[model samples]
Target: MRDLSPPAPRARGALGVAAAVLMAAATLAAPAHAAAAPAGGTAEAAVTAPAPPMGFTNRDSTRCRAEFDEAYVKKIADILVAKGLKDAGYTYVNLDDCWARPARDDQGRLVPDPVRFPNGIKALADHVHAKGLKFGLLAGAGARTCDPAGFPGSLGHEAGDARQFADWGVDHLTYADCGGGGDAEQRYAAMSDALRATGRPVVLTVADQGANRSWEWDGDVAQVRRTTGAGTDGWGSVLARVKQNLPLAAHTGPGRWNDPDALHVGGYGMTETQYRTQFSLWSVMAAPLVIGSDLRKLDAVSAEILTNREVIAVDQDPRGKPGEVVASDAGRWVISKELADGSRAVALFNETNRPRHIATTAGAVGLPAASGYKARDLWTALEKGTSGTIAATVPAHGTVLLKVSADREWSQLPPLLDTTISGDAVARPGTTQRVASAVTNHGGAATGTVTLTLTGGDGWTAQPVTAASTDRLKAGATLGTEWDVTVPAGATGRHELTLTTKYRSRDGLTFTSAIPVPVLVGVTRPPAGESYLGDQAPLAATNGWGPVEKDLSNGESNAGDGSPITINGTVFAKGLGVNSPSSVEYYTAGRCTRVTAQVGLDDEAGTQGTVTFEIWADHQQVASIPKMTNADAARSLTADVSTAETVRLVVTDGGDGAAYDHADWADLKITCA
Candidate 1:
C-alpha cells in the first residue's frame, strides 16, 4: 500500500479561530516519535518505530477455494491489477493453506502441490511480480499446517523452509499456529531469525490466534500480529474482534501492527449497515485492509466501502497511532484517532440494537477550544458546522465516522449554533410529552437576539413552558427551552414537531433553520393469547453469531441457514436459537404474566459449547440457569412477568470463549392478558 505516500492536501477553512484552535489541540495530542517513553518504557518506544510498509492482499479469496491451480492464482493476480483494486492500494496476491504438498521433496524442501502448480511456485511468484504486485505464502509453525490435508509445515525445518520461500521470491509469509506446536514464542522467533538469515526481506505475519497476549511481544518478532482469528462474517465475530483488539492500540505503530484479521465487507454474513461498521472500525484501528472476498465477485457497494480514501487515510496516517475509545456510555461509544494533519477522526458508534443519539465535544476528543468546528462525514463526504457538539442518531450496529477540524475558515461562515433535543419521543394518544431543546452559540462573535419556536403537525399541539426568546447571547453561551407537546387522542402513528431557530450574525445578517423531531404514538401490545416466542418479531436482537433464528438452531452465521431447534436429540417445533453473548427482547406492554421455555446448548454445537441462560423482565433479572453444556439434557425454565413491560431472553458464554456456544430456547411460550 503506497499508504506512506504523502496524502493529498486537506480542505481548510472554518469560522472564527476554530482552525487555529484545533491546530493547537492537534499539536498537543499528535506527539513526535521521539517523545519521552510512555508508561511502558524505552523498549516499547523502540518497537513503535515505523516498520516496513505493506499493501493489501487477496488472502481470503484463496482460502475460500477448495484447491486453487496455477491458472486460478494467475487469474487473481490479473484481477488485482485490472479491477482497480491495485490502484486503490491492494498490491499482494497471497496463497493460504493447502498450497503445499503434505510431504517434503527428496532434498528436504517444501514443495508445491504437483497437480495444482504444474508450473511450480517460482513461476507463479514471477507472474505476480510482473504485475507489479508482491507474492505471499502461508506456513504453519507446528509439524503440519491448519488445513485438514496436513500439509508439511516449517517446524524443525525453519531454515530450510525460509531458504525455499526466499528462493521462490516470496515477499510475505504468514506463520500460523496449528498441528500441536511447541512454545509459540520460541517457534515464531525461530522462523523470524531464519527468514532474516536468508538475506531476504520477507514480511512475517504472526497468526497465533491472539494467544499469549501477542501484542505484548510480537512487535519485534513479526511485522504484523494477529490479534484474533478470522472469525465468520457474523456481527458477533466482528464485534468480538473489535472489543478484544481495541485496548491494544498502544502496541501498534508504523511497520508493525495489531491485525484483527481480514476485511469481511461485501460478504454475505452481515447486513450493509454492519458491513460499513466493520470497515469504519477497521480503518480507525489501523488494521490491515486485507480483502477477504473473491475478487471476481466483488460488488459495487463493497468496492465503495473499501475504496473510501478518507477512511483509509485515517488508517494510513503518517503518525501510525491507532484510534482509542475516548468515551463510552453503556453501548454507545465515541472513539478518537489523531491524524498527522492535526485533524481528528471521530467515530460515534452505536453497538446496541436500537437507534441512539451519541454525542461528544471537541474538548473531550483533544481539540483545542475553538469558536466552532467543521465536521466532514467520511462516509457521506458531507461537511457541516458544529458548535463544539459532535453528535448523531446512529442506527443499530452503525457508525458515524467524521473527520473533524477546528477553525478552518470561521469568518466566511455564519456564527455557529447547534440545537439538540432531550426527552422521550414516544407517547400514547391524549398524553403530553415534555421535551427540551438546547441551543449553544459556538461562534467566535456574539449573536443578536435568538428566538426559538415550536410547531407541530395537524391535531397536535405544542406550547413553550416559558419564554422561548433570549436577548443577545455571547459566544460559548447556551439557551435551554422546554415545551409540552400533546398527542391528539385520535393519533395512531408518527407526528412531526418542527423546532425552528432564527438568529442574526454579528454583521447583522439573519439565518434560520428548522429541526424536525418525530414523536411515535400508540403502545405496542403483546400477543392476545398464548403464543410461541418465535411467532413474534423481537423489538431487538443482538446475537453473537449471525441473526437470531426462529424455530431453528443457530447453525452458522447466515440468516435462515439453521436447522430445526434441537437439544440432546430432542426436537422442538417452536423456539429461538442464538449464540452466546446474545439477547432478544420483546415488548410486553406490561400485560404479560408468564414466560416458559426449555433451554440448553443445541446439539448442533457438538460437545464443545457451554452457555448460561437468563431471563430479564423490564430491567430486572427474573430467572437464570448458571450453566449448561452441549452434553447436558435440555432443562425446563420459566419467568414471571405479571407487571413487566418488556421481556428479554439472554445467553452468555460460560466464563470462557464464545466459540461454538450455540444455545437454544426450545418450546418457548409466553402468556399475556
Candidate 2:
C-alpha cells in the first residue's frame, strides 16, 4: 500500500533548484512548440508567488460529456482568447477527470492518458501558459476515482502528485469527491500540506460534496470548497444550491469561497431567463463562476450572459464578502452584497413560476438613506435614480440585479419612478377595463410636465379618466391617474398595452420610460375540482433532476425515467414524482377546500437522501413535514386551502445538502366545494 503521510519539506532554495532541473529536462522532453520555463537565474528572485487567480473554469463541459482530450482543451483555450472571454475574467482552462491513466507508473507517479494527451502533461501546461492562461487539473482522493473508468487517484499519493503537478506547471488542483479512506480532514490536510511543500502557489479546490460541512474548516485547507452537490441544467438545481449556500455566507472571504458548482448558463436546457438568474445569483453569492458549456459552439445569448462585466465585477469584488439574504418570503428573495466602493449589489429574485413584484429599500440593502441613489440594472445596463425604494416586477425564475450608489448628482439624470397598474388588465372583447396607474417620483428634484400615455396597437383605445398630466411635481410625490382601456372587439389572445411616462429632469433632460401592461382578452380559468392532482396539468412545474413525473417517482434523470410513486415500500398509483428543491403549482381559483397527500423521501433514494415537504396555499405555508429521511416511512399530510387562488407543492433539501433528494407526493388529491 502507498503511504498517506505528508511530504517532507525541502530546503529554502530547493524550489529553485528543482525548477532549474525541470527546465533543463524540458529542452529535450517537450515538443518544439512548447515554451520552456524561465532560467533558474530568475527563479530565485521570487520571494513569494501568488496563488491561482480566482476566475472562471470550464469544468462542466468536460464532465458532462466524454470529450476530454488535449485537442478539446486547446480549442477551449483558443475560444477563450479569441472570443474575449479571457478579457472578461475567465482565465483558467481546467481539465476534469479521465485525463489520466488507470494506473500509476513503476515510480508510483500518475500518468497522463497517452492517447488523449500525446505530448504529455508538461507540454499541455506549457501550451496553456503560452496563451497567457493558467492550467488546472482534477484528481480524486480515494483508492479509485469517481469516474466510471476508475482512473488512478491521489489517495495515498498526494505528496508525489502535488510535486508532479507543480513540475508540470499546473496552477490549480481540484480534489474530486471520492476516495480518501480515513478521516476526510486528514486526507485533505495531507494534500494541502503537500501542495505548499512544493513552493508552487497552486490553488487548491476541495470538491468534497459538502459531506463534512467543509466550508467551516476549508478556509485553511483549500482555496475553494464545494458548498453543494453537482448541479444539473434545471432551475430547481440552481434553487437548491442557492438555498443551501445562502446561510454559509459568513464562512466565505478573500481567498476562501463557497462554490455552488459551475455555470449552467448556455447550451443547457434552461431558458435565457433562468440562465440570467443562475448567473446573477451566483455573482451575488460570491461563488466561483466556472463555465460549464462547450465554448467552441457557445451561442450569442450565452456569450452575452457570461460576459456581463457588471455582473462579473460583483463576483470578483475586492471585499470578497458574500451576499447575505436580506429578505425572503414565499419564494421571493433579496440578496445584498457590499462592494469595496461603498456600493451594494442587490439581487431581487423570483423563485416561483409566476411573475412576482419584489420590493426592497436602499437602506435595507446596506445603503444609507440619501437624497437620491443611483441604481443600475447590471443585466440590462440601465440606470435609474431612487430616493429609497429599490424594487421591480421580477419575471418567473428571473432576477433583477442592481448596483446602488449614493450619488449626489442623481438629479442630473432621469427621475426615478415607480409605475404600477392596480387592476388586472384582463378584459373581454369590446369591454373596457378600468385601472389606475400610479407614478411615484423618487428623485431629489421635482419633475416638469409629467405625462402618462397609454398606447397599444391599432384597435386598442385608452382614454384617461383622471388627470394624466401634472404641471409640476415635487420630489417624492406620486401622481395617480385612472384609465379606461378598451380591448379590441375581436381580440382573442394575450396583448399588451404600453404605458409610457414622459418627464423632464431637473437638468431639463427629457426622458421616457415604458412599462408593458398585459391584457388577457377573453381568457377563462379552469373550474376548482380536479381529480388526482397528478392527472391534471400544472400551471407551472420545475424539478431538480428532470421533468416532474405524474403517477411515478422521481427517477435518475429525464422525463418518464421513474417507476411507480413509491414511498418507503408502498407504491401509489396516482401522484406527482419530483426531485427535492422542486415545485409544482396549480391554479386553485379560490375554490379548493383542502390538499391531502402522503409525502416522503422516495424509496428510489435508497438510504441516502433527506427532504422536507411543504404545501403552500398562495403565499401561506398551509402544511409541512419538518424532516424526512430515507429511513422514515411515508407520512400522511393535509393542507387547508379553502381560500387560496393557487396551490403549490414544495420539496426542499432537509437543511443538509442537496444529494439524491428524490421525493414523492403520493395519492395527491385536492377537494373543492
Q: Write the per-residue lDDT of candidate 1 for residues 1-673, one digit (tens) a residue.
A: 1111222332322421243233223333332222212122333232222422334444555563654778888888887777677766666677888788789989988888878898899999888888888788899999999888788889999988987887888877889888867788778878876765665656688887676566665544676888875666678778777877898888776657788888777776788889999989988888877777776777888878877878877776767678899987757889998887888999989887655678899989888888678888899776656667787767678998998888667644466577767777568999888999888876566788899988887788888896688878777788999899888998975566778889887668787766667666774666777988668767678788878999999988689999989999999988998997788988787788999999999888898868899998876889999999888999999999888877899887674457788999999999988
Backbone clash total for model 1 is 15
Query: Which candidate has the highest TM-score of all?
Result: 2
lDDT (Cα, tens digit) per residue for candidate 2, span 1-673: 1112334542223453343234223322222112223312122221111211334455666662656788888888898888788888777778888888889999999999898899999999889888988788888877877888788888889879988988898877878868558777667777877876666656678888788787765555666788898887778888889988888988776556688888887866789999999999988888888887778778888989988988988887766678999999988999999987999999999887655678889889999878878999897677878777887766678898999999987866566777667676457898888988888887777888899999898899989999998987777898999998888889975687778888877678777776667676765444456567776667678888888998888897777989988888898898888888888987666778888998888888889888899999988998999999989888999999887867899988886677778899998998876
- Against the correct fold, how does model 2 do in TM-score? 0.88
State every prediction's TM-score relative to the real structure.
Answer: 0.75, 0.88
- Which residue pairs clash within candidate 2? 142-179
How many residue pairs clash per model? 15, 1
- Judged by whole-model lDDT over C-alpha atoms, candidate 1 comes out at 0.76
Task: Pick out the ten consecutive residues of candidate 1 with the lowest summed lDDT.
Answer: 1-10
